[model samples]
Target chain A: MADIVLDKVSKSFPDGTVAVRDVDLEIADGEFVILVGPSGCGKSTTLNMIAGLEDISSGELRIDGERVNDRAPRDRDIAMVFQSYALYPNMTVRENMAFPLRLAKLDRATIEQKVAEAAKVLELTPLLDRKPANLSGGQRQRVAMGRAIVRSPKAFLMDEPLSNLDAKLRVQMRTVVSRLQKQLGTTTVYVTHDQTEAMTLGDRVVIMRGGAVQQIGPPQELYDHPANLFVAGFIGSPSMNFLHAAVEEERLRTAVGDVPLGDRLRRELAAEDAPRELILGIRPEHFEDAGLVDEQTRGRGTEFEAPVEIVESMGSDKYVYLTVSGERASAAELEELAADVGADGFGGGAANLVTRLSAESTVAEGENRRLWFNLEKIHLFDPSNGRNLTLHEGRAAGALAS
Target chain B: MAASDTTVAAKWRWGLLDVVVVVFALVPVLWIASLSFKTTGTLTDGNFVPREWTLDNYRTIFSTNQFVRALGNSIGIALIATAVAVVLGTMAAYAVARLDFPGKKALVGVSLLIAMFPQVSLVSPLFEIERSLGLFDTWPGLILPYITFSLPLAIYTLSAFFKQIPWDLEKAAKMDGATSGQAFRRVIAPLAAPGVFTTAILVFIFCWNDFLFAISLTSTERSRTVPVALSFFTGESQFEDPTGAICAAAVVITIPIILFVLFFQRRIVSGLTSGAVKG
Candidate 1:
């Protein structure tokens, strides 16, 4: 196994559509890197190019630092698990997993042994003789995994393998995939449009948009300290909320109210020009019920009431949409603010902000529009570039508890 | 809930009415079957069912020379034609479906045009060609004509079938180290079997029922197929109203077609629908 590197990669379809453009990424040996983006954003295309399923339109692709632009998928020693699973619907589970080995022309005894082991690994021993049509979605995904595992290739390329499964199966399969990746320790490049999968599966997730790499880092790093607004908005569920706020003598004031700028934000703005307008990003779980509320508490850790517009009760937590001070924030504006710190005004009507609170925290919709957010956990961004001003350590701690 | 349940029951009753409409369309085929089973005496009597049941009419025809030979000839030609059409057509279909060679689309388009061409238009030219090749009055002559006539339909249907196969299977086969040819042969061919069968069965029925080509092309008994043989059973100038013989021959000839249809009807319907519809 060796590091897979793409130096300024780009793909242009015959129809003159550019799927990915000037993307640069280097995955270390045995690393689990996920490419995440919105639908049709070219994350899958990038992975396909690496797997040799799609020819690179432009750029250098190197496996082990040796360029493999012309190599076939098998010659590149890359195994792919397709979004459709692409299991041989006609072939039995054992045959499907054993196909690559069979292609490798291994002896019958060896092929059988390898297939058995793969089946055992995937808990498909009982399903070995069954065709893909008989397997459940999760089981088919595991069989797909088993197929790649049997190859023991330099790297595994997976394209949205979990998308076909139901919600619960997708979550369960996430853990299975992570454990499998760790156990195999083969360099893997997995692509998914789902942000939660990107965060949960990748050691380092590469967030992509419009066939370009937006940012690459550990999952929490990208989530907490997203390099730009797109990464910030695209990396989290219900996404990050962006609000238009202005800096005034070490204090930032918004339509809702005023809050003091903490040392972290002020210091990051110290060497640079403190612009009049700034974009503030807040994650879903950063808000809480107001037990303590004040400018001092808001400076680092405080709470304030914002009216709730929508409430979605997930079993473990409640996702509340808060319109701060009746100021409307477009998703694009929020995304832009997340990318460019000290950004210009995105203030419109009512700002749409999402908050994840404990399920027991009964913030009933239509009961009260008001809710509270923790200012200490709030994300400060430049309105112009959507760059985060404060690099708080708490941002990188882990996934939000909720 | 009760109101909704009543509505659903009413909808099912409407569905039953639609099935009755469909059954009305099938009355003619049922009538023809009933006509075939009756004695000529009953048939002339205009009775739906014969009061006097007799196997003598069926027995008389089965024991005759022309009817038996014609039956054998029809089966042979249909079988040969279908086999050739399916094998060659499936390969041609796969090539047209998957390969990126030059003029591929044009070739496919030309084949479709050939299928839609009236069989009578080609009969004279084909007869002359067979004559020059000295293939007239031979099995090869018959096979050649049937193959040409059946091709466009076969290729058109099977190509549609081939298109339905996920390109990924061929890619997976490629990943499994099969060359393009091997991938087509091992993966595509097997996967497309039902469609091929469907195409073959339909093509066979076409060849079997074709009297114009079979009668016009073959000169004598040495090469004459079922239709020619059956027409001869009618006799020349005598105007012999061997109505029972004709009916018996019709029933005999139809039995195999019916059996063939029964064997592959489900597959034909499924394959045809699959080719036409997709996600």
Candidate 2:
């Protein structure tokens, strides 16, 4: 219903702690934008500023082209679903959902009708008379959603709204949230620390770190081309494998093996400022069991042999953890990413690689397995700065520059 | 079989303990009721139950304007003091629980110190000040002291209750198109009702049962409460004992306290905020 613009909006507490800084975001009308990051990354703070729950220390916030920096949350016409659900326990489901409408001074009939419609949409018609104490966690979550949608506010700000559900319920409610957002066509700004939610729920994902916007792009675009080492590590499951690489003549010597530089990589490496030492990043899915790859596909990538440490079968694929002779990837950004996951010094300095192979492959633990990695998909990062050297043109450069 | 036997023994032990506590608490109350129904001749009899029951004691107390006016003063002063204390305490306790300002901890410490201070120590100074301020021997005289002494207790209890309420509900209300005032009244105040009621009952009881302040502050029947009036009670004749009539007034004043506890006890015990947030 409205486009939300946060132009260099920042939030700093009186004690001189900056919660969010220079966060510039432009969410189009009816667009579902997700702000994702680790805990204390300022994603929730930015969402609060957008919802008018927190004051913006600097810059402007506009809704539908009107500057609303001074507007109260009620005047801004926004609805927020808190992580805890925050249901009015004193009110029944019907009254809880009808709260916003009643506050708007809607007539009795219209409030009842709107609440009924929202309850039906959320499949909470059966629970209209029940208090929240009698409802299950998922039902309480739906009531929170119903409360937000009943009034059809200008935008919906969700702060980890689905994080409280069980794993199976979370998945079920993810689709429900997706469908509801699509049906309502309301501009939504959702904040979550869960990267999977960011990947699946938003039209565009805005990744943040240390109060600054890191990258903004569609899910697949960010997955395919992350702007930096943090995005590369933060966006994927099992995360992208990082290995220290030493640039040599026409080749990059890494812990796994010497990677022959293709023309595209060579072109980027030829820049005068390119470092002699770099970091190579490859996603887990990029590695396939060499025995299962076809001749044509095998020819497009490089094959290396390593001793497999563990093999985990995940129905459709096998996650193979392999160890090779090299030092682990070391960089400030990589350390911060590891610490974000409470994985300080994970796997030691053994230079282990996590590869996803076809489930049919017979790569058992303690066996030397030849893995094929797609060369074109490999990303090279500057060791000192964590910049992706291979991202040299177009949207990626623009995203990184921000 | 042994475990079941031990569990049965434990239940019996607890049941016996419960009986002891009930008897300990109820015996004096029943004794007072028994005394109220006794004739003046049997008032000192050694029997547990009244030897000769009579309606004469109740009839005597209600017949006089002295005891009736004192009862009226008790209700009026206690009700006003409780209402004012709860209102002012709720606001102060809410600020203590939720808001951060300079000297917040100091305010809490000071209120707590006031709660721990001896009320008997303030009676003399209060009597002097009330007389100079023209508050002596009036409802406001007793009501003012009652409010001041009970306010700290109300604030402490209400603040503890307010601390458990999730702050998110208020923010959610605001985002749901409610102004700050509406958010508090519609969302917060209702959730805080049990605490408010609990604090109100406590303040009421404190004001109702206060003897020192009532006796010290009032010198006339116009403002004397039941407890102070009982001390000043004279028999039908100077030689006659007023024990039966005094016991009757005691039972009457106790009825309101019992009713208050019975009426709002359920509200005080309900976990009204249990489902307000994710647990």
Give one digit per residue, the lDDT tens place, for model 2 in A1-402: 899999999999999999999988899999999999988899999999988889999999999999999999999988999999999999999999988888889999999899999999999999999999999999999999999999888999999999999999999999999999999999999999999999999999999999999999999989988888889999989899999899887888997677787666676667898788988998899899888889988866888899999999999998999888887888888888889889886676588789998999988889888888887788888888778877866233311121
- Compute each candidate's TM-score over C-alphas: 0.78, 0.95
Candidate lDDT (C-alpha), each = 0.75, 0.90
What is the number of backbone collisions in each predicted candidate, taken in the order shown? Answer: 36, 0
Best by TM-score: 2
Model 2: CA > 4 A from native: A248-250, A262-276, A394-402, B1-3, B236-240
lDDT of 1 by residue, A344-378 (tens): 46434667677888777868775554445666556
lDDT of 2 at B142: 88
Identify the runs in model 1 with alpha carbons over 4 angstroms from their true place. Answer: A246-253, A258-278, A285-305, A308-321, A330-348, A356-402, B1-76, B95-118, B121-145, B234-248, B255-279
- Give the lowest summed-lDDT range of ten residues in model 2 chain B: B265-274
For model 2 the local lDDT of residue A145 reads 96
lDDT of 2: 0.90
What digit string (tens of lDDT, one per residue) describes model 1 on residues B89-208?
988888888788889979977887887888788889888998899988777788878888789888888888888888766665665566667677766777787888789788998888
